[model samples]
Target: MASFGWKRKIGEKVSKATSQQFEAEAADDKDLADDDEANWVHATKRRKEILLEDCVKKSKELKDEGANLAENKRYREAIHKWDEALQLTPEDATLYEMKSQVLMSLHEMFPAVHAAEMAVQRNPRSWDAWQTLGRAQLGLGEIALVGKQTRV
Candidate 1:
């Protein structure tokens, strides 16, 4: 009976040690999973930032090319370049305003007005946008739309 009791004690001790070891391994796995999730989130944010920077750089280059083209009186090509820039930076009010002016030079009144309106929508405080809008409206024979408070 005494020997049997000692064997039972040894069995309980082994069982407890095995249970503790499993719990410790589970904790380590949970921690590793948490770290992996955190790393993924950080990497995703960095990728987004990189994409934005690339877009901005490309858009700036396109805008400069468009400006040079416009200066040389290549109106259609300038408009195309500006359109490509706008695709990258749709919220750029200046691009829209420039496009509006080019459209006006082409005698495209409706499109000019639309582009100028988009400029104004993007930057309501831009006097250039307002001026372009007013001129485009006038060219479209909508003088009534060009109110006395025209910023231009």
Candidate 2:
């Protein structure tokens, strides 16, 4: 009976040791999973920042091209380039104003009005945008006046 008691004690100790080993392994696994998740999140953030930087760079290039085209009096092409720039930086009132100017030169009254309106939306306090809007409105008014005169 004494030997049987000793054996039971030894068995309990072995079972307790095995359980402790399994718990330790589970804790290690949990730590590794947490580390992997943190790394993945950091990588994703870096990728997004890189993409945004690329877009900003491309927007700048397009803006330069738009300026060159406008200087050459290629108003339609300049407007197209400015539109591409705006896609990358939609908040730029300057781009919108430039596009509005191009459209105005082309005598595209409605589109000129719309582009000036977008410029105002991007920056209400922008003097250039306000001026562009005023000019576009004047052009539209002139057309309307002409139509009325013709009808009469």
lDDT of 1: 0.93
Instruction: Please identify model 1 stretches exceeding 4 Å from their true place.
Output: 1-26, 148-152
What residue runs in model 2 are displaced by over 4 Å at the alpha carbon? 1-26, 142-152
Please, what are the lDDT tens digits per residue for candidate 2 over residues 7-96?
A: 345455568879889889999999999999999999999999999999999999999999999999987788888889898989988998
Q: Looking at model 2, report the run of 10 residues with the lowest lDDT sum.
A: 1-10
- Listing every candidate in turn, what is its Cα RMSD in Å to the true structure after a full C-alpha superposition? 7.2, 8.9
- What digit string (tens of lDDT, one per residue) describes model 1 on residues 62-145? 999999999999999999999999999999999999999999999999999999999999999999999999999999888766
